[model samples]
Target: MPTIVHEFDWPDRIVVGTVGQPGARTFYLQVRGGRRVVSAALEKEQSAILAEKIDEILDELMAGEGNPFSIQATTPVELVDNEPLEMPVDEQFRTGAIGLGWDPATAQVVIEAYPLVVVDEADIELSEDGDGVEAIVVEPEEMLLVRMPVGTARAFAKRTREIVGAGRPLCPRCGDPMDPEGHDCVFPEA
Candidate 1:
């Protein structure tokens, strides 16, 4: 089957937002271009790492000797989006893998999210000669792709970090997330 690609080049709005309470929040990477919107469910760690990597890429570009592309070191004020995820919040797919890259030509950050792949015994195929097992390869049925300029990228990272940090507080002693009801801390022996 051919893969369905929800591509948004130079998206007008792209962000990582959550639904539900902090402890049980569901993180979503949503992008909008015109009236078209795509939302992909992702883990909190994935969102945090994506933001960290994007900042690293932008910072590196900014620190270049001449700074040719003029990457912004901070999120542009005008591009800051604090609004909640778009209405309906229809989830197209749950992200299995995320790919990030920089397009030097356009000075844009490219993000690609692939749907989780589930392999069943039926998916496995036998070798031509049926002598040995064939290698297994899994492909997603759909993916979300977005490209954002430097300023927008910076803003995206900033908002994503904030959203990730807003989750449950960490236990001061054990460094584990604290549940609203309570927390059991296990201290290490000296």
Candidate 2:
């Protein structure tokens, strides 16, 4: 079957938002254009990495000779979006892999997210000779494709970082996340 693509070109809003409380939060990459909205569940680490990489890309462009693309060093003030995620976020799928790219033609950042692939024992088949087991290659049924302008991309990265940092505070002693109740920090013995 052909893969379903939720393509958004220059979406009106795109953001990384959490559903639950800090420690038990679930990260979501949501995109909206017009009345259509798509949300993909993703790990906190994935969200952070995505934002970091995007900023890196933008910074590199900004450092280019003569700053040809006019990449902003920081997110544009007018493009800042502090609003919460759209209500009733219906997650389309759990994101397994994410791809990021730069589109020079449109001066936009392209992001693609693929759903997680799960293999079941039932998917395995016996070989023609019935001697070996053959595994069926599973492919994602749906994916999300979003493209944003440079300024929007920068704003997105900034917002993502803030959302991620809003989570559990770190235990200064061990550099581990501290629980709301308390934290039992472990240290290496000399």
Candidate 3:
């Protein structure tokens, strides 16, 4: 019989940690001393986040040791869904999670839109079919921004909105995406 594994439980001894990436829709986590497992308890929207967190954790573990660890011990150390595949982020999102603010002392990014915010933003070129990224624009959260085609801008905006509605992959506040490992938001008090 074909084995269908929906989700697995973590062991009692496994420890859990989190990893956040910039502009990523889901929060990646690091689970220590556990079996190789996938989850499906989360909704379609959550599939991306869980997969991202798991991949990140596993990658780190593999990179550090140069070998895949055996997933031993099975029980829930932390909450995780084993189903639902996360949506892939476009190339333009490289700096999508950067906040809106300009640092006078630092450089800035170029935005295609006018009156750009001070936060970091990326410029993506859309193709006629409008699926894969044609090109990318990276700039600081200040000064000169890039220019985009009308159609491309519209598509980019729509994607950005989707990420935000998904609970933001980076800091809870500021709405900036974090690195694959995550970033500490330094937003100042008002």
Misplaced by over 4 Å in model 2 are: 121-137, 188-190
Ten-residue segment with the worst summed lDDT in candidate 1?
Answer: 125-134
Q: TM-score of model 2 relative to the true fold?
A: 0.90
lDDT at position 121, candidate 3: 44
* lDDT, residue 54, model 3: 37
> Where in model 1 is the C-alpha error above 4 Å?
125-135, 188-190
**TM-score for candidate 1, residues paired by index:** 0.92
Per-residue C-alpha lDDT of model 1 across residues 39-90, encoded as one tens digit per residue: 9999999999999999999998899999999987888899999999999899
TM-score of each: 0.92, 0.90, 0.19
lDDT value, candidate 2, whole model: 0.92
Candidate 3 residues 28-103, lDDT tens each?
2111124442211222233344234334433344465434343222222233233222323112112123112211
lDDT by residue (138-188, candidate 2, tens digit) is: 667899999999999999999999999999999877989988898878975
Error of 2 at 100 (Å): 0.6
- Top TM-score: which candidate number? 1
TM-score of candidate 3 relative to the true fold: 0.19
lDDT of each: 0.92, 0.92, 0.30
